[model samples]
Target: MVAVVTKRYQILQYVSWMEPVGRRSLADQMHVSERIMRTDIDFLRQQGLLDSSKSGVVLTARGRDVFTSMDQFMNEMLGVQDSEKQLAERLGIDHVLIVPGDADQSARVLDDMGTALAQTMQVMLPLGEQIIAVMGGTTLARAASRMNFQLSAGRELTFVPARGGVGETVAIQANSVAAAMAQSTGGTYRVLYIPENVSEETYQPLLNEPSVKEVLALIDKSSVVIHSVGEALAMAERRRMSDDILQLLRDHHAVAEAFGTFFDAAGNVVYKIPKIGLRIKDLDQIPYVFAIAGGQSKAQAIQAYMQHAPKQTWLITDAGAAQSILMG
Candidate 1:
């Protein structure tokens, strides 16, 4: 067991920093010979801690849990000194988990939140036969990483991306994010193969396609929806909004954006981007809506989203953002 523990620790440490890496790099980092590193890696593979391919190595789903648990244990044992907890409590959220360091330290905090959110979905969602709708963002991507496929057993859950591509980054698109989450949960996924913003004339024709209509119908029937909130300015920048629309947002004092619609704190629609995806009214039909966002910068945007969210919605956010919301 001593050998097993040491190998696990070594593999965990290496993957934590040098993820998507190869066995050769792991050996070089540990200063161990290639032969020994190979042996250690093989052991970890047998234990399901390391997933290796011809290209590189990544932590398996099980391995992520081990690493996350260790980090959380160390942080709690060392104690957190951050002042963000007060902010979380004031926001009326269920719980606020804070990482006691700066943005660099908060990566793990975000990871933890993702894991918790995934676990929550696993426990709360009905086994099989549920439709889950998801939106895309950096926060949701992180949450996707911590999720595991084991939690979806005996469930026939179908995931559909709530919107379309926002920017050039393929990873942050709703279709890609929805696919990732579906894979993590051992469920199937459907992609919305269109941009978030399109002209009304373009959308009308696209809606006539059989595939688009099918996905749209599924989105309307979703029982649970998971999403991330975004600041209006940031989203505008991401979507490459026209100068006229930017000025319109400024005129309306828009603070937050969700599902192609921008809103101010009062829940009034500032502007609506013509996007070919799920409508805000569809969210109203869902029984459960889970909104996850973090970082101090997103506080106002999250607050704006909360103002418009249904009464049964649940929010998952970090202490940093929570504090900002409370202060505002």
Candidate 2:
């Protein structure tokens, strides 16, 4: 079958390039086992394409031909570029699927990113196991809008607002975005009812309330987090930050805003709003953190978030943002 051929071909390619590699190493790389590698190797050897010696196993002359064909196929499939691949690598992300163009092309890029993300989620997440924690923003809302709920059948998932966005505009509020995503995925949701920028006095009290407390507890348990980075200047304007706070951020050259916190490109805390929602410590506990944002304007924001983000965080952005990020 074509499926079986594809699997064996992949194994051969890995062994040929990573040859002199032991059974354990092959198993580890393929996330399989020594047994599986041995079986595949035996099959390859029988095909006369692989030869085994006392030292280790390697490709035979015939094997090299097969390796060349497979290598060419892989190159064609992954023929983006070294520079772009390096950008993804530098971000320490698993994959960076970029759509070409600039800020003016953001709508098309966002559509493509959303569709790709929806497809990726369908593949990466198993049925009845997804737990998404989301932030609210225009880009995120668009992404959620494009999700295919039919692909999530039998999934027992819940979407929770990553932070409070009660006072934010409807389109960019955490609760609104989470609810939209939940609706799109045919899942349920829990909202952070409290405002993102409540007074310190109000914040402590709200956190003690049973309703808010329950949502915060759920957020802590979330395994996946999806959020958008915000430019500090734009977010300050949106939040109506005090003139003094704005001045402080400008003085420090603050570039990004995340979960009510602002940071400069160097990862220094420029300013913070006392919000009653998920804390930075809580973000670290999640296994998958997807920071989704795009456009040249969001480059600095994305960079600043990447600097302070948890090591496991994965960034999803477009070519414009990626190029701007490298330039910065």
Per-candidate local distance difference test: 0.71, 0.72
Assess candidate 1 and give its lDDT: 0.71
Off by over 4 Å in 1: 1-105
What shift in Å separates residue 141 of candidate 1 from its native position after superposition? 1.3
Per-residue lDDT of model 1, residues 231-304, tens digit only? 99888888788889899998899999988889997778898777776677766677767777777877778777
RMSD to the native, candidate 2?
9.4
TM-score for candidate 2: 0.74
- How many clashes (backbone N, Cα, C below 3 Å) per candidate? 2, 2
TM-score for each of the candidates: 0.69, 0.74
The sequence of per-residue lDDT tens digits that candidate 2 reaches over residues 82-149 is 54466666665544545566544648778666654664454345455677888777778888887756
